[model samples]
Structure formats: C-alpha cells, structure tokens
Target chain A: MENEGRRKFLGVCVAGATAAAAVAAGYPVFRYLAPRSGQGGAAKLVIPVGELKEGDAKFFEFAGSSAVLIKTQSGELVALSAVCTHLGCIVQWVKEKQQFLCPCHGGQFSTDGTVLGGPPPRPLAKIPLTVTEGNITIG
Target chain B: MIRKNTLAILLLASLAFLKPALAAPVEQPETVCIQCHGTLPDRLGAPVKLWRSSIHADNGISCNGCHGGDPKDAANAMTPQRGFLGAPKEKDIPGFCGRCHPGVYKDYLSSAHGRALGAGGPTCVTCHGNHQVVKASLALINEKSCTRCHSFDRARAIRDAMQQTEGYIDDISRRIADFQVSGVDTEKMGKSLFSVRNRFHTLFHDVDVARVKGESAAINKELGKLDAALKEIEQSHQKRRVAGGIAVGFMVLLALLFHLMKKSYD
Candidate 1:
C-alpha cells in the first residue's frame, strides 16, 4: 500500500513539474512568434506641418534611426536620413547654403539627398512622407 | 646626386615614422597616370609610390580623382578640355584641397594659420603632406611639428584639453565595435559617435585653446551619455547570462529528480 501511494505521488509530481517546464519554455516562444505592437518600432509618426518653415529642418527618430524633415527654400517638403554615406555620421543642414553637410568628412548633399561634393560615395537616403490636414505623416 | 639621394631617404624615413596608421592601398586598375608616371625615374615616378599608402589611395581616389582628368581615355587624359587640372602651386593648395574639404578650408582661412597663408605660413601640404596624407590625429600636434613656426605652448595646451575627450571617444568606439562584432545593430550609436569625433577633430583647426576647453566639456558630456548606454547593455548581458545559468541548473535538477523516480520504480 505504501509503495503504491509513493509511486502515485511521484508520478503526479513529475507530471506537474513537466507541465511547468513546458509552460516556462513555450511562453517565450509564443511571445516571440506573436505579432509586435504598433509602437514597437514600426508605427507611423505624425508631425505638425506648422512646426517647419521655409529652409527649416526638423530631426527626429523614425523607425529607430535618425531622420530629418526639411522644408526647402522653394517651399518643398523633403525627408531624408540624416546619416552620412561616407562614414555614417549625421549630416547637418546648412540653412544659408540650403544643403546638407556631413561634419565627418565635409560630404555635401542637396535637399533631394543627392551627393553634391566631398568624399561621400553616395547620396543620403530618402524617407517617404506625406502632408495632410496640416500634419506630416512619416513611415 | 648622393646628397639628393640621402635627402630622399630621410624624407621617406620621416614619413614612415609619422604615419603609423597608413592603410594598405585598395586595389584599383592601373590608370594612365600610374602606368605612365610609374615608370619614370626619380621625382616623376615617386608620386605613384608615395600615393600608394595614402588615405586617398585606400579610398580609391586615384590621381585622376583630384586632378580631374579622364581616366578612361589615355589620349585625352591630359588635355585641357578633358578637365585636367595639373599640380597646384603652393598658394593654391588650400583652394585645391578646399574643393572637397570646404569646412576645414573655411576654418583654416579664419585661423592664424590661414591668415599667414602665402607668406611662409603652413598650407595644408605643410602639415598634412601632399601625396601621403594620413588620417589626422592629436599626434599631428607634436612639439617638433608645432615648434617649426611658433612655440609649442599653445599647441600643447590644446592637445592637453582634447586628450581626455579623445580617450573617451576611443573607448566608446571600441565598445561599439565590440557590440557590432557580436551582431548588435549599432548603426545609430555609431553614427552619433562619428559625428562627435569629427566635430572634435575639426575644433583643432581653430587652434584656440579656450574654445577647445569649453567645447571639450560639452563633448565629454555627450560621451558620458553614450558610456551610460553601453554600461546598460553590459548589465543586460550579465543578467541574461545569470538567467541562463539558473535555467540550466534547474533543468539538470529536474533531470536528476526524474532519474531518481525511475530508479525507485525499479
């Protein structure tokens, strides 16, 4: 009788422990497989259009990297990755010259992100954006 | 002839000593400039060999890149219409190099060095060299180089001010590189660091000790923030390691318990 009782108890304990272990392992896998929340790095950003003016640039984090929104002197809105192509340094917008200049190696870029001069082998990357209802929406 | 050879030897030796970080030349197809000038004796062929170790060469900026000639066409390579600009004179070196490094050129123009240009003042070639220009560093502000034109006191002061911040930058850079090697997405942090480093180096062109001291404090604050981020990453890694160890230990203990239960049945 004693042996039977002990055996039954051990079996129950083993099954319970196994179930607990399975849950501990499966929860992480389930979380990993689940769809991420919108705020988890892929959400669209909205900025007020009034915050920018002619020949002005506003730098902000987009999709987890540095990006910029610029209003050119011609009243055109442009979005570009602020990262310089030469050495990955952030480019500064020169309001006077109406161009982007990489402080790292003096790489120059026009408002459209095209490489104008210096050692940069390529242009700054362009980010897509839209203006609607006095708000700028970027992805 | 012996004296000339000795001077050339001395120059080469000094350059080798000065440029400890010379990068290996990036392989490129031979251009007409290299093909033709590489064979000529003495002064004519020397530029090709000297340029082989330059930062420009490492970036694949061949003779034609700066000289503005058609590298594809040997016949029209040197023609005026082909947009070839021959070697610049001493006075025009700043303008020539400034075509690309306009910010540095502008800073140089406003500096004491810039004001002294054309009247025995050091042009870009004086310190940076003409063909064998390496990456700029605090090493360029040595007593021997600075004392050539003026006293080393001001240069020494500026270098002292920058040394701590430079150390911070280098340490953070190494940490970032380590993270990158481990497959972490370090692009954003790396770019910010690069901008800070470049801006710090550009401050040297101004040659003002007070400004360097003032700006270095701000730069150090930025570096401190980055250092804190790196520290947070390190802490997270440690926590993960400990958690992994506990998980393994728990699994092993459960295995032992299962074995014990099986033995009891037998």
Candidate 2:
C-alpha cells in the first residue's frame, strides 16, 4: 500500500510540473505566431513639381486611396484629400473661380483648403506631403 | 505500526512538495482564460482586435488581473474556493484600479463626479458601469461622450456663430482675390494680414508662450481688430452688390423707354 501511494504522489507531481511548463512556454509562442490585421504595406508615389501647373490640381493613387495635389496661383504646393467632408464627393479645382468646388452640393473650399461655403463640416483632410529633389511624394 | 509510521512520513513529504507547488503565487490563473477571453468578439461580431495596443497585453497584465481564482479548471473558477482573487467590490474597485492607474484616479478625484463620490455620491461604476467595459475609440469619445453634455442646441449655436464668421471671412477673401487680380499694391494690407496670421499661429498652434511673451494676449487683441475690419469689408461688399443691381435695373429701364419712343415715332 505504501509503495503504491508513493508512486501515485510522484506521478501527480510530475504531471503538475509538466502542465505548468506547457502553459508558460505555450502562450508567448501563440501570441507571436498569431496573424496581424490592418498593417498597411509600403507604397511608392512620386510626382514632379514642374509638371503641376499653377492653380491646377492632380490626383495620385497611393496606400489604397486617392490623394490630391494642388499648386496654388502663388506657386505654393499643397496636398489634400479629394474626398469631401460632407458626403464623400470628389472635389475639383475650379481655376476660373480659384477654389475647390464639390459638384455634389456646391460646397466651395478656399485655395488653402478652408471651407468657404456650403455644407462641408470641416476643411479638407490634409495628407502629409514631402518635396524631394523637385519630386512631390504623398502618403 | 511500522507500516502506519512509514505511511505518515510519506503523506508529510507529499504535502510538503504540494505546498510549494500550490504556493507558487497561484501562477496567475489566467493562462487559459486568455486563450478564449483574450480574443472575444467585438460588438460588430468581429474579433476584439488591438491586443497589441491594449495596456494588459503591453504591460504583461493578463486576464487574471480582473477575474481571479484558478483558471486551470473552469469549475474552480466558477465556485471561487479559498485563495480567490476575483472581481473586487464596487467600493474597493477604485483602489484596485488605482494601483495601476493612479493618474486617472487623481484626475477623477478632482472632477465634479469625483467630488460627488467623495461626498457619498455614486462610485466610478455609476457613470462608466462595470462588466461591460468596452474599448474607448475616437468616434465613441467625440460622438457619444461629448454630445451628451454639449447638447444639440449648444452645438447648433456654436455652428451658426462659426458660419457667420466664416461668411465674413469669405467676403474678405474675395476682396483680397479681386485686389490681386486687379494688380493693386496690397503690400500694406499684406503686412497687417501677416501680423494677424502670426498671432493666430502662435496662439492656436504654438501654445508655449513663456519663451514668446505677450503672444497669446496679442493674438486676442489682433484678432479682434481683424474681425472688425472683416465686418467693415462685408458691409462694403453688401453696398457694392446693391448698387450694382440698381445700376443694371436703371440701364434696362432706359433701353425699354428708348424702344417705346422709337415705336411711337414710326
């Protein structure tokens, strides 16, 4: 009876230790191996400054979306979203009026992207743009 | 008797070994809890992602931090036998949470709700609630929380004021555009505009003003003057529009009279 009890106790101890070890080692590996979502990949987009005329705007596709590039009459370059704040209407540069006009609701935005009139709740969303060696890169 | 003595010794040794294993600080009963609870679905039935951004996951805090008792067995977790470290009481909840988030607790204590709580008001669970703790998102913060206190009327009033001011700005901008188009020397006007712009940039964006003394107050004063000038410009534009309309109407009337005279002569 004593030998049997001893064997049973030893078995329980070994099993408990194994279980603990498995739990400790298994978790970090599980987390590390887990697949991640929403990690946006790299994108390459480049537009020459000289190509964009004064008071004109251009659009480029990067990072799975469209970005608008505007060159003001003062020769200053700014990049903003073509997506309107009201209902996602695409805004176009109206050179005659010198403003960004959304054809959807007559929403007008200033040359600097400030909401001038109509139903836009806020200014146009600005995407960070960089000028490198006369090349305009937006993300 | 000899066999009984040996049995007692073996039992004592077994207890000794088990004591150390059991006392291993309960081994954070959450090892298994995280397997299921950690990846629980969100409200949209999608998985409650952002585990990487979570404070629990970042600081090595696990599910066991809140729901205690041994997680190895579901039965033990449910019953919560001795050595249970389960959900704390509502009163003790603050202290328990404060252990990790003292800054938030301090801020809360100074707030109106915190003062009320101190004066025997409702606990933290009163406003935030318990068990149904969802992740706070930007949309949630802006839409749900702020609107609750701000009210529709207040929001509408603010929006109306903003629109009125924006209209005045549009008139000024149009004038500036016209002046530029007509080749007017707006150098003096540009100097004033730059000053106002500098003040606005300093106040709104660059808030550190000890290094730049009197900037914030200067911005307020300059903005007041700019607003007055904008109001004057709006009035002038209104006058111009009315005058232009009158002139067009008079010209049309004269043309009509000339045609009538020509017909009578014939």
Candidate 3:
C-alpha cells in the first residue's frame, strides 16, 4: 500500500513537472511567433499637400531619422532620406540648384535621389509615400 | 637542401604575384594617366607616385577626375574636346579644386588667407600640398607648417581649442565604429557625428579664433548628446548580459531540481 502511494506520488510529480516545463518552453516561442503590438506608432507620417511648393523641400523626421519631401520643378512629388550615403551627413536642399547638397563632403543628389557628383558611392535612399485626400502620407 | 630553397623561392614569388589580387579592389581602374605617367622619370613621374598615397587616391579620385579628361581614351584624354583641364595656375588652384569642395573653397576665399591669395597668401595647395594631400588634422597647424607664413602663437591657440573638440569627435567615432563592428545599426549616430566633424573641420578655413571658441562650445554640446546616447546603449547591453546570466542560472537550477526529484523517486 505504501509502495502504491509512492508510485502515485511520483506520477503526479512527473506530470506536473512536465506541464511546467512545457509552459516554460512554449510561452517564449509563442511570444516570438505572435504578431507584435504597437508596431506602427510614428512609423507613418502625414503632411498636407500644400506644404511643399514646386522646387521646394520640407525636411522632417520620418521613422526615427531625417527625411525630406520634395516637389520637383516639374511638379513631381518625391521623398528621400536626408542622410548622405558618403558619411551619413544630412543633406540640404539648394533652392537655386534644386538638388540636395551634403555639407560634409559636398556629395550632391538630384530630386529623385540620384547621385549627381562628389564622393557619395550611392544615391540618397528613397522613402515610400503617397498622396491621399490632399494629405501626403510617408512611411 | 638546394631543392627545398628553390621551392621556397617559387612559393614566395607566387605569393607576391597574388598579393595584388588579395588586397583591396581598386575602385577606380588604371586610367590612361596612370598608365602613361607611371613610366616617366623625375618631375613627370613624381605626381603618380605622390598621388598614389593621397587622400584623393584613397577616395578613387584619379587624374581625370580633377584634371577633367576621358580616363578611358588615351589619345583624347588631354584634348579640350574631351573636357580636359590639364593643370591650373597657382592663382586658379582654389577654383580648380573648388569644383568639388565648394564650401571649403568659399570659406577659404573669405578668410585672411584668401585675401592674400595673389600677393602673398597661401592657396589650397600651399598648405594641403599639390597631389600628396592627406586627411587634415590639428597636426597640420604645427610650428613647422604654420611658422612658414606667420607666428605659431595664434595658430597654436586655435589648434589647441580645435584639438580638444577633435579628440571628442574621434572618441565618439571610434565608439560608433565599435558598435558597428558588433552589428549594431550606428548609421544615424555615425551620420550625426560626420556632419558635426565636417562642420568643425571646415571652421578652420574661416580662421576666426573667437568664432572657433564659440562654435567649439556648441559642437561640444552636440558631442555630449551623442556620448549620452552611447552610454544608454551600454547600460542596456549590461542589463541584457545580467538577464542572460539569470536565465541561465534559472535553467540550471531547474535541471538540478528535476535531477534530485528523479533520484528521490529512483
């Protein structure tokens, strides 16, 4: 009777321990596989269409870094990261030249983010954006 | 013994031939300018050797890049139709180099040095050198270089002030590079540092001591912010390490508990 009681006790302990181990291992995996909450806060930005004029650029923070929204002389809307590809300096828009100029190493880029000249190995990165109901949304 | 020595010699020779291929790839291909000028003697050949060690060469700025010629075509390389500008006169050096470094050129022209450009003031080449220009540093403001034109006292004061801030920038840059090597995304911070460094370095061309002091304070404030951000990351990494240790300890303890329970049951 005492042996039967010991075996019963051992079975309970094993079952409980196994359940605890499964929970411990599976919870983290579940969390890892689950969709994250609060993923898009400040990830999307909105600016009014009227804010940018032809040949004008408006620099603002986008997705945690400096980004610029530009309306080309041809009235085409474009968005690009302001950071220069050469050494990561923020580029300034030259109103006269209608191009982005990096103050650091004089790396120049066109409105479309093409490297026009200087030491920048690559062009400025383009950011996706869209105009909807007179509000420009950038991501 | 003779056979072994010959084998070693052959191995060394082969390794020497392979060294170029194993080294960093040349971003700019061997231009016609290098092909021709590399062979000539004395002054004609001197620039090629000097320029090979230049900051320009490191940045892939070949002869055709500055002189304006077709790097590919040898015959048309120096032709005016190919947009070749051979060499600028002493007075035109600023404008020539200014084609790329517009901000520095503008600042240089406005400084005391620029005012004395033709009469006695130094041009870009005067301090930076012609083809052997390396990266600029506070070392350039030493007695040897600066005393050539004026007393080292004022230059020394400016250099001292600039050197302090440059030290901060260099430290921050090294820290950021360490983070980058460890696979952290340091792009934003690196760029911020670069912008500040560029602004600080270019401030020298203005040659205003009071302005330098004023701007150095402001730039130091910016550097402080970057330093604080790095500190924050360091703290978080420490916390992570501690948490990892705790997790490992917990796992080991759980294993031991299970092992004891099994032993008791057995």
Q: Which candidate is the best by lDDT?
A: 3
lDDT of model number 3: 0.85
User: Backbone clash tally for model 2?
Assistant: 0
- Chain A TM-score of model 2 comes to 0.69
Q: Over the stretch A1-139, how does candidate 3's per-residue lDDT look in tens digits?
A: 6656766776676667667767866876998898878764457889999998899999998765679999998988999999899878778899999999886667899999999988899989999999999999998
Error of 1 at B139 (Å): 1.4
DockQ for every model comes to 0.38, 0.01, 0.34
Name the best candidate (by DockQ): 1
TM-score (0 to 1) of chain B for each candidate: 0.80, 0.31, 0.83
Interface RMSD of each: 2.7, 49.1, 4.0
**Model 1 bad stretches (over 4 Å):** A1-69, A79-81, A94-97, A116-139, B1-41, B73-76, B261-266
| Sliding window of 10 residues with minimal summed lDDT for model 3 chain A | A2-11
**In candidate 2, which residue ranges exceed 4 Å CA deviation?**
A1-44, B1-266
Across residues A13-103, which tens digit of lDDT does each residue of candidate 1 receive? 8788788888878877997899867755457889999999999999997765678999998889999999888877778889999999876
The models' CA-based lDDT, in order, is 0.84, 0.56, 0.85
- Residue pair clashes in candidate 3: none
